[model samples]
Target chain A: MSSQDYWKANLKLLSVLLFVWFIISFGFGIIFSEFLDQFSLGGFKLGFWFAQQGSIYGFVILIFVYVIAMHFLEKKIGIKEEENE
Target chain B: MSSQLLTYIFVGLSFATYIAIAIWSRASSTNEFYVAGKGVNPIANGMATAADWMSAASFISMAGLISFLGKDGAVYLMGWTGGYVLLALLLAPYLRKFGQYTVPDFIGTRYYSKTARLVAVLCLIFISFTYVAGQMRGVGIVFSRFLEVEIQVGVIIGMIVVFFYAVLGGMKGITYTQVAQYCVMIFAYLVPAIFISILITGNPIPQLGFGDTLVNSSTYLLDKLDQLSIDLGFSAYTENTKSNIDIFCITAALMFGTAGLPHVIVRFFTVPRVSDARKSAGYALVFIAFLYTTAPAVAAFSRVNFIESIQEKSYLDSPDWFKNWENIGLIAWQDKNDDGLINYSAGKPFEGSRPIFSDEFGSQGQREIKNLPTLDNSNEVYIDRDIMVLANPEIAKLPAWLWL
Candidate 1:
């Protein structure tokens, strides 16, 4: 694949990752906090859990997700820095 | 005659070590100055980043903030540490790949615009200076209490020390020095905590002690803190009084803001490889979590102690500890009803006695409290939240030498 194609795929993956970020933090944390709160998890109030601890856990997950996604993106693009001539 | 002198001698030696390190590690080139030639070890960088990030707030003020905030205080815990996620994943490697000396340099070069660089620099100066002013003030407050110097003199001394290292060695000197500082500060923080935790819970591990039932209390330590908080006209420790929407937006804003902070992102750039940047962040988080997890426990313990000790006392009978803080202008009680005693109600005023009433009173009553000024000279509310942390160790009935 050419550099142009690689950049295109990278951008697509980025958009999906950003959407997931929005869903966990803004969606579950705010919009669906009430829905989530119906189910108690350990010591935390669901909404408060999402707001405090849950969203944080989600963020760490998202980071790893991006890392794995980026690794695949690098492979797909054939432009991994380690392989550069 | 001996111990105090020994303290002075020990503190003086520490200061000398810092100065010597600053002088020795001074950087000549801009690259060396800004990123330490991008060759820092992952572990060293982690320690350095921890100190750089902890600042006076973490060392001196965070536990107090957590004590007062309770469960909502987790925002600081999650938001602050969660930022490392943003740093490690979103910003760190990309910025390192850009291979710049400063954050502004990365921005300026990436977009290929001088104007962008200039704007970035301007914003950097504004943000850094505003935050630095607060840190300097914190240093002054800490110094005044520990060193027994006047606050203004403390500020001057702090500025001189910071300026010598920050200006002379630039980023290189600051980086290595910060690693040393991380050791000093973490030791300072952990020593007191370890002692206090063992003293109170018969358990020295603060993290576990937080979850474990207190020695005398039936509930987990946090539940007791929550119960105590409600009894004292405050919100419960584990409860969320903030609207969910507000919490979500604020947390989101903070997460992004953490990722965007230039200083933190800049730390990642000092590592040799993109992989190193990723790993350094993991290390940084672990180092930071050492304090973050422990802080809430410290806060819970201190709040319980502070209230239990002082809740029933009359204003005239308020402990020597309370009076000491009042002398520093950190705590005050206005005798709203001319009552000799200060109550939890004294801190919170109703409709009329609020700021509007106070504004009117200052203009009308030549008869305000004599020793304490109602406001700082700037006419702002005078309660300094930072004082809560400083007062905690003392309020816990820790020894006088603990301040050192």
Candidate 2:
């Protein structure tokens, strides 16, 4: 893929990941939290769980997911970052 | 050894180690100082980033804040971690490509304006002063609480130690020091959390422990806590008191602030490859999560322990730990009922927020305060939110050296 095309693909991946990030943190964590509190995860109210721990766990997972996706994308584009500077 | 002497010995040893590391890793030149010669390994850099990002506030104060704020504390939790997502996904790669590797450098050159560069420098200085002030306060809290020194002495001592490492060794030295700090921070934060979790819920893992039923009880810990909060006239432990709009705004502000914090942004420059920059953020968050996930459990456990420790107890029967904190002036009891049973409820016991201690002993042998009781509600305890975390080990009666 051309550099511009590669950039576009990267942006697409980022947008998708960030969308999940927002939903998990802002959406479930705050906006729809009261509604979601009707449900329970383990002994925790679902919204409370999200507010406390779920969003943090989600963030770590999303970042790693991006790393893995980018690794595959880089391989596909034959862009081998030099291991040594 | 007394807890006091033990704390001093432990603190002294740790300070020696940090100074030793700082001297050992002193930067040789501008390249070494600016970006650690741009030679840090991704994993090491990540550890450093976690330490740099976590700060003194995260180490000492965050769980305390979370304990009191209840559901509304999500702002700090999500805002901070979310900002990392933004930093890693949105800003890291582009900044890596910027080549200059500093925020001020990026702004100046990007705008092609010396004025912008100067402005960036001014902004950094302002932000840094506030950041350092918070750091010194964290140091002061630890010292005053643990080692029995004045808070001012603690801050002055902290300034000297930080100057030795950060100012002398610069980023290169700071990174190595922070890597060590991250380990110490996570270990110190988690050990008590695990102990408290097991003590309260018969669970070793604090993340799940908070959700587990209280030991030998049918009710869940949260249910019990919610009941305790309501019985005491405090809001339910899981309920939100801050307006949703306020939570949203604060969370966003923290998110943006975390992303834009100069110190954290600068850590991305330490890595060699752009991919390493991304990976480092991931690793940093992973390290950070060890504390973030456990903070709520600590908060819950400490809150439960604190209320159980003090509420509805008489001044004559109050625990030494209670009196110890009260002597420090973080814990104040004004017996409004004249019966002297220490009544702790939602509102302040006196006017103007904090009590003005009169240095005259009350009839109950409590340190007398000049502030008149507001008499709005019968809550006679004035407990600083900071006490929940700082006083946890003492409240929970954990060993002196478990954290040391």
Candidate 3:
């Protein structure tokens, strides 16, 4: 892939991941928290759990996913900063 | 051993270990001083990042803050950790790839203007000083409460130790010592959480135990806490009563703000490769999540125990833990109805949260706090929310030294 293709692929990965981030943190934790709280997980209501606990767990997992995805992308396309001569 | 003695020995030992690490890792070159010679292992850098990012507020006060805020506390949890995601993916690797030592340097070259670099430096200075000032106060609280030293003496002691390592080791020194700090700090944070979780819910893991049913009872811990809160005229524990917008703004600010801290960004440069920088952030969040996940559990457990122990209990007959924290002034009982029993109800017990102390003592031998009570609720007790986590050992009757 050309450097531009590599950049485009990188943006796509980021967009998908950040969208998931927004849904979990903002969508579930805040906007729809009360609606979602109708369900329960273990001792916590679903929304409250996401607010205090689950969103945090989701964030950690998401970062690792980014790391793995990016590592593979780097290998396949090699966007590792090149020196211009 | 006594709690005081344990604090002395453990605190002394940790300081000595930090100083030793600083000496051993002294920067041999300019590169080492700036970013550990840009050769740090990814995992070690990640651990050090966790230690550096958490701050005194995270260590000493976060659990207490979450306990008080209840559902509202998620703003902090999400904001801080989510900020890391932004940092690793969008910011850190790019900064590392540029091979710059600090944010100002990166801005200076990228923007091709010294003015932009100066602006970055100014912002960094402003943010760092305020952050450090709050941190010193937290250090003071731990020293005064745990070690029985004056807050001033404690702060100076803290500064001297920090100065020694920071000056001597540079970034390499700070990095290694910080890794050691991550171990000690997390151990301290987790032990009390585990103890309290098991004591209340019969589960050893605080994360799961937070959602587990209370020991020998069918009700969930969160459900029990919610009921206990309402029965005492306070809001339900699991309810998110704050406006959704308020929560969103705070969480967004924190998430983006996490990537903004220049100090944290510097950690990315410490690693060898751009990929290493990204993986290092993932690792940092794992260590951070260990504490963040447990905080709400600590919050709920401590809230349940706090309300149960103090609500409607007469002042003189109250547990030693209640009086011990009260004596430190983080807790107070104002009997507006002339009743001797404690009732921690909704709303601030005083006009502002601060209590004005008179020289006179109450009938129950509690200090006479003459602050005009707010007439909003029939509540007759003033309990500072910060005491919940620190006093959890005493509340649960767990033997001391668990935290130390």
Cα TM-score per model? 0.81, 0.97, 0.96
lDDT of 3 at A33: 95
Tens-place lDDT per residue, model 2, B53-127, is: 787788778888988878887788898888989999998867876778589999999999999999999999999
lDDT of 3 by residue, B129-232 (tens): 98888788777666667756655876887776677778999999999999999999888878988988899999999999999999999989888888888887
Q: Model 2, A1-85: lDDT tens per residue? A: 8888889999999989989998998899999999999999888999999999999999999999999999988888898765325
Q: Write the per-residue lDDT of candidate 3 for residues A1-85, one digit (tens) a residue.
A: 8788889999999999999999999999999999999999977899999999889889898999999998888888855543210
Q: Would candidate 3 be rated incorrect, acceptable, medium or high by CAPRI criteria?
A: medium
Across all candidates, the chain A TM-score values are 0.79, 0.94, 0.90
Candidate 2 Cα deviation (angstroms), residue B332: 1.2
Candidate 3 has what TM-score? 0.96
Q: Which residue ranges in model 1 land beyond 4 Å of their true spot?
A: A1-85, B1-3, B314-318, B334-342, B349-383, B400-403
Which parts of model 3 are misplaced by more than 4 Å? A78-85, B149-153
Residue B150, model 2: Cα distance from true site in angstroms: 2.7
lDDT of model 1 at position B311: 64
